[model samples]
Target chain A: MTPITADATSLFDKLWQARLIKDLGDDRGLIHIDRHLLHDLSSPQAFAGLRQAGRPVRTPALQVAVPDHIVDTMPGRGDATVRGGADMIVALRRNAVENGLRLFDIGDPRQGIVHVVAAEQGIVLPGMTVVCGDSHTCTLGALGCWAFGIGTSEVEHVLATQTLVIRKPSSMRIRVEGRRGAGVTAKDLALGIIRAIGINAAKGGVLEYAGPAVTALSMEERFTLCNMGIEASARSAIIAPDETTFAYVRDHCGSPEWLPVATEAWTMLRSGPQASFDREFHFNCTDLAPQISWGTNPGQTIGIGDAIPPLPEPSAPRERASAERALAYMGLAPGQRLEGLPIAKVFIGSCTNSRISDLAAAARIVRGRHVAPGVRALVVPGSSRVKAEAEHLGLDRIFIDAGFEWRESGCSMCVGMNADRVAAGERCVSTSNRNFEGRQGPGARTHLASPATAAASAIAGHIADCRQVAGR
Target chain B: MKAFRKVTGTGVPLGRSDIDTDAIIPQQWLITTSREGLGKGLFSNWRYRDDAFTPDHGFVLNEPRFARAKILVAGPNYGCGSSREHAVWAHLDFGIEAIIAESFGPIFRDNALRNGLPAITLDGAAVSQVLAQLAALPANRMTVDLERAEVTGPDGTAYRFTMDEERRRALLDGIDDISATLAHAPDIDAFHSADRIRNPYYWVQPPRD
Candidate 1:
């Protein structure tokens, strides 16, 4: 083990120090926001607040707005398909035009999920502070940025001042050593970590993912891993930029005059050789299995082959009671196998697992097989660009031939705010982030899994392991 | 937003861990652009049954004893998922002015405070004690005093909690966060100028038509 210096500072500290605009006494600091990403669901209130206050966006050039969350994901959908969402979509466009900010409307080639678009278009950069009205803003932290979600009030604050008054979060480092097993994806690694540590393990702390396993993951995988940081109650999640990160940014951001200088600076954005964190956790993913959430919370997950464990005799009465409640809500008995559990639908999309790589992985599984009878499967790309790329690679043909509904790019079933939703009393295997009760729809049972698992389960009509189904 | 110096109400003991935002306000209720009429959707999944919207007999909030409670005492990590301010709006619409929990999700806590609803965090023992006391005497009221940073049970047992002084003051005075952030305009200008020079590509604009 390498010994850290007394002055060693984690990458989070460096980013924080760089963005600190003013020390507002106490633990609060006014931090400059380099990029502000907005979506239709949460930004309307912020825009209304700004209007009520008679204020204008302080730095319109730094902000970008998109309509993703509540937009319909059907093939021939338009803004009106969002049913009760027309007002929000119209409001977002009106606000962006009024403020002179960039608005990526429904047919724009650059439009996509806010986080995905930010990364793909180089709107989010290393060593910068980014924020969004959505919680999954932390997804951009995979690019070595200090990004996190804010409430509508804070969103208005950032819009009016291009800065936020925030208290510094404590720092924690999660180190995943050893190599991951075959067929294991970043989604499995994230679920495994959340299971080992309870949902609140990193409460109010910034988590920096390190070690060999994390470094070995591709940029898409890193986004998937960090997208769920909020699930663990983390303030933010980040990974230091490396060669893989540089390559991805270069390929996507295009050739700008500042490319050489920016690339050189990004190399220095990583932690020191012996950086120290306030708290450290180490997990070895050598023999880890594909993970699946059995209950409501993301923490209620287990490896694919593992049977559901019985609720423990919690030391606190509240824990015991809540565990029983979750069990009842999930309609699962103790020691039930997650495998062979009948599923009604399968959805493959979200900021978490809707990248092109995720599509390819699922396509590989469903290439020769078809969705089972009585099962409804849907594949939604994260962005229009990703959708175009997947179509170019013929991934859409593979999915459509397999009886999966290939849809337009948007949040889609992940949030259930649009036309896409799971029916009441239905069970769905999803690649989206959260598995909270009624998240997909009222009385809709959601099982969070990786894209491969969701694809394989669509073919099997049950919760099936991708490893066995794909013969990996 | 309502100013919050102190609030006195019966504590509805949710006693459920990781009660997420989705469970608080389901996605179906998120369609409306306005925040009005969200109170009816609060805990709709657990509070109501069937399309008729009949109150569920087993839900804590629907229980006759806690039907009108204005303060919620929940288990650890309450409001754990999503950054939906509608969750906070639902609580406020339902007349909940404060939430006492062992811990809270970072975004949820911020949303609560921004809406002038205090999210008070106490240790596990203190929360457990409060829940137990509330269960024993359903009619007993709990008082949260932001001025003193304390929560008092009906039995006169007081628990001390800590919050950032700035947020505490903001909730007490109903300070708008946007105005507070704008107060540091000069500092923001200084940082932005330097940052723009340091990373020009990020600030560059495409040619306008």
Candidate 2:
């Protein structure tokens, strides 16, 4: 290891300083925003605010808008087909047109979940400051960007001035060492990290993934791992740029001539050999299994073969009560094992696990097998390009043959913004990020898992270990 | 934005941790272009009975005593998940002027301040004390004093809190943040000029469709 030098700076510290438009002192600064992303659900209010205030977009070229959350995801989907989202889509299109901002409308082949679309299009680059109206914007941090989620008010601020005043959040380095077990995908690693750290442990702070396992993940898998940053409510989730990131960037970057120059500069954005952080967490992934959340919260997760532990003792009243209530709402007991717990629905897509690689993984499991009786399974791709690529790979046919509804791209049942909600009083095994009460639908119970686990569970009509079911 | 210096009102306790924005206002209610009437959707799944779509009498917001409460006290990580500022708008429209908690989701914390609602955070013990005090007496009035940088509870207890200096000044003045940043244009321009030279790779905009 290199000796600690006086200038050994962390990745975030370098980005924070590089983007500082004006320092306000006390860890607060007016930072220059490199890219601003807008979605139909949150951009309308921001645009209206700007209109009311008579403010023009300060840097329209740096902004991109899409209608992902509220668009219908049917095969031949149109803007007006969504139950209550037509107005939102129309509003976003109008706002984008008026502001001269780039937009991928409903029929555009590039339209997708803002985070996925941003990374896929190379709009978000290493060491850039990226913000969006949606929390999952942290997913772009997988490419080594200083990216985070912000509210609509901040969105308006960025549109108006291309700047935001923010405090320098503390840092946490999460080290995932060693390769994961078979069938233990990136989704499982994400859930396992959240399970180790509670929902709020890293709130108001940034988290950087390091160590051997994180460095070895495929670019798409890194996106899956970083996508769950919002589940931890982090200020941002990040990984330093490496050759893996540079390879992906070389393919997607808009300016081919700039790749060598950009990659060389971005290589310096990595944390110094002797960098320090406020907090550090280490997890060994060699023996990690496919994780599933039996309760409402993502942190309330256990391995595939594990049973729900006994309720917490009263020493911590809030946690105990929360666990007790989650148990009641999920219709499970203290010792109930997740395996074989029958489910009514299976959703195998989200910004976290809907990439082509993720779809391919699920297809490999359900090639010849059919979904079990009494189960409704759906696969919503994260973007239009992903859907096209998936179809090109013949994964759609495999899924359709296995009794899965192959749908278009958008944030579907993951958020129930569209009409893809799980029925009330029914249980669903989903590959989405959160399992909170009513996250999919009112009174709908959700269990978060990997694409493999979700597909395997759908075939068995219950929660099952993907490794055990993959052979069948 | 409304100016927020001090607020004194009855405290309503919702003793749950990780109260995500989805639980605050579900996507079902986020379709509207306007920000008004969002309070009806605040805690939608919990505050409203599913079948009837009427207020659930058991919900604290539906209770007559807590209906008039302008301050809410909750456990850790209040307003976690989702970057929907609708949660803050719903709280403001619902007459919730301030929130006291152990910790808050970072985005929610900023959202609340930008909208002139101070998201006051106390230590876990103090938050528990406040929740207990409010639950024991639903009629208890609490004062969140931004000027004093503390929360004065029903029993005349004061818990000191911290606030971002710039945000506190902005909330106190109810000024547009854009205007505030414009005041430092020289510094911003200097940085912009330097950034163009230092980071040319980021300046390449994507070609049109």
Q: Which candidate leads the pack in lDDT?
A: 2
- What DockQ class does candidate 1 belong to? medium
Tell me the tens digit of each residue's lDDT in model 2 across A1-472.
Answer: 9865565799999999888887788878999999999999988999999999888998898899988888888887778655667999999999999889999998898998888889888888899999999888888899999999999989999998889988889998898898888999999999999998877767668899999999999999999999998787677999999999998987777557878887888989878877899888898899889999989899999999999989889887888898988999899989999999999999988899999999998888899999999999999999898999999989999999999999989899999878899888899999999898889988889999999999999999999899987543
**Fnat of each prediction?**
0.78, 0.72
If scored against the real structure, what TM-score would every candidate get?
Answer: 0.97, 0.98
As a whole number from 0 to 100, the lDDT of residue A448 in candidate 1 is: 93
Q: Check candidate 1 and list the clashing pairs.
A: none
Best by TM-score: 2
DockQ of each: 0.67, 0.72
What C-alpha lDDT, on a 0 to 100 scale, does residue B100 get in candidate 2?
Answer: 90
Question: Per-prediction RMSD in angstroms?
Answer: 2.2, 1.8
Cα deviation of B182 in candidate 2 (Å)?
2.1
* B1-209: candidate 1 lDDT, tens digit per residue: 67899989778887778888888898878887787899999999888887689989988888877888889999888888889999999999999989999999889999999899999999988888888888887456989999999999868898899998888988889887776667777888888888788777667753220
Error of 2 at A280 (Å): 0.8
The parts of candidate 2 lying over 4 Å away from their true place are A1-7
